[model samples]
Target: MNLGELEKAALQYFWSHEEADAKQVHAYFETKRGGSLNTIQSTLDRLFKKGLLKREKQGYAYVYRQAMSKDAFIGELVADVTKDFFKPTENALHAAFTSMSSSLSDDELSELETLIEQQRNNARSE
Candidate 1:
């Protein structure tokens, strides 16, 4: 998700729905985010060119779909971000996490703990 705002919005639109023409995407922003049609179309086209989206011609318009599943995309992002974030030290990450953890719900903290335990177990097994 290290993309520009319009690119992120366009990707989110693709994530929640099936392939759509640029016009459909533009219409959504026109109502929801209130951006111009050209902006939406340019974002979609840029995403297609960047290999983040699949595009196919349907009669006159090109319909676009996400190239990868949202889960996969997020997993890659998390891995990349963690690699960068934890490059300094575990203590730094811990301090940052502690500061941010207050904003998370109890269920979210529990789930994160479970995931951390799972990763630790997997690492030990490996």
Candidate 2:
């Protein structure tokens, strides 16, 4: 499921809040971008069509929740991007790691190194 910026924002809102009404989502976005209620409604409709959100009737309103967990959705998104743009190449992985490394703390780098060693050992065993 390819999500647009607004869809991503909407999904994140639902993810953080557990459940959100259309009005709440609109209000949240309004604090940032100041879009209309109709705009928010349309974006929610698009997210629903894309199967990224589930809606349930709540009184006179609809409450939205994520159709998938955040981690699962992010993993799928990363896999899709890798498959589409990187052809699952080691060079792409290297670039991603290098880019991430620049932002990591010393402890994080150490942890990543340990993870790499574990992956290498697993590969050797395989």
Candidate 3:
């Protein structure tokens, strides 16, 4: 499922904070996005089914945690966006990477370089 704004926001919130129950998430939405408790609960369920979250039993309620980090989530989104929106061409990929790289911080850029190096090493080994 494509993560619309609300779902994406919920994931972002979960990534920054520790695990939370549906009621707690609903309260967060009430303060910010103003959704009902049931709505938040439904959203959480949807996220769980989408493999974005893992839920654990917490007494009468279930506490949910992120299944992936924010960076991993963004990477998946970027890959999906690339496949769905861009043409299958080297130039398109190059342009997409260039556009995205300009917004990265120095630390993020360093991390990306490390990832690319690892990818290259993997390719050589293969």
Q: lDDT at 7 for candidate 3?
A: 86
Model 2 poorest ten-residue lDDT run: 87-96
| Over 4 Å off, model 2 | 85-106, 109-126
TM-score of every model versus the real structure: 0.65, 0.66, 0.72
Q: 1-117 in candidate 3: lDDT tens per residue?
A: 477788888898899888999998888789886878888888899999999999999799989999999888887777777777767764556667899899999999999999999
Residue lDDT tens for model 2, 23-53: 8888889989898999899998888888888
Local lDDT at 18 for model 1: 87
In candidate 1, stretches whose alpha carbon ends up further than 4 angstroms from where it belongs are 85-126
Clashing pairs in 3: none
Q: How does each model score on lDDT?
A: 0.84, 0.83, 0.87
* Tens digit per residue, CA lDDT, model 1, 30-110: 887798878888898889887789999999889999998887787677656666666554655565668778999999999
Give the range where candidate 3 is weakest over 10 consecutive residues by summed lDDT.
86-95
User: Could you arrange the candidates by lDDT from highest to lowest?
Assistant: 3, 1, 2
Clashing pairs in 2: none
